[model samples]
Target: MPTSLCGTWDMISNVNFEGYMRALGISACLRKIALKLKLRKVIEQQGDQYLVKTLSTFKNYTISFKIDQEFGEFTKGLDNRHIKSTVTWQGSKLTCEQTGEKKSRGWAHWVEDDKLHLELYCEGEVCKQVFKRNE
Candidate 1:
């Protein structure tokens, strides 16, 4: 069985997020707002399918995908780009690879100890976000 990543996680620390946003060509105005906002990531998983939502006061982003399946991903409200994306399990980590204008774009999610960890990468910049499970 796959390791469970099916719980609500509250963001505790975000490192290098600005660098990641800059690499994605996010406008300065939007980045300012995003940097200050608190975020909650809610994940629901059933077998191979998953629904993940990133909620914030400024904007919310959601995506649904199944393991090993390629899907068209439209990142609306967040980078406003369309990309072909796929998610697969690499050991205990869930990894997503996005193909589009950006090179080497992807994110990996895993659980460490009692914390949920995310590494969001675009181009060469990587943003690390640590979250604690929400009760």
Candidate 2:
């Protein structure tokens, strides 16, 4: 059976998000706000379909897609850019590719020991985040 990612997660730690935002060409004001904002992730998984919502005080982003299916995505609050996104499972890790103007843009998600781990990358900067499962 495929791994299920249906739960709420609270941010525990974030590393290098400011640098990553800079690499993405986000404004300095936005980067400062984003660095301090708390993030919550709510994910719903049904079969091969997934809905992931990322909530923060500064911005909220939601994405819905099926496994291995490519879809057009617009990053509304984050960057206001369009990209073609595809998500696939690599073992227990969920890998996503965002193809657009940016180079090396993608994210990887995995759950280990009740903690949800995320690696968000763009350009040459990488942001690592850890979230604890909410009870």
TM-score of each: 0.97, 0.96
126 Cα displacement, candidate 2 (Å) = 0.6
lDDT of 1 by residue, 27-135 (tens): 9999999999879999998877899999998899999999999999999997999999999999989999999999999999999888889999999999999999999
TM-score (C-alpha, index-matched) for candidate 1? 0.97
Winning model by TM-score: 1
Error of 2 at 31 (Å): 0.5
Candidate 2 deviation (Cα RMSD): 1.0
Off-target runs (Cα >4 Å) in candidate 2 are none
lDDT of 2 by residue, 1-135 (tens): 445667999999999999889888899988888889889999998767899999987778999999999999999878889999999999999999999999999999998888899999999999999999889
What's model 2's lDDT at 111? 89
Total clashing pairs for each candidate: 0, 0
Clashing pairs in 1: none
Off by over 4 Å in 1: none
Give the worst 10-residue stretch by lDDT in candidate 1: 1-10
Which structure among the candidates has the greatest lDDT?
1
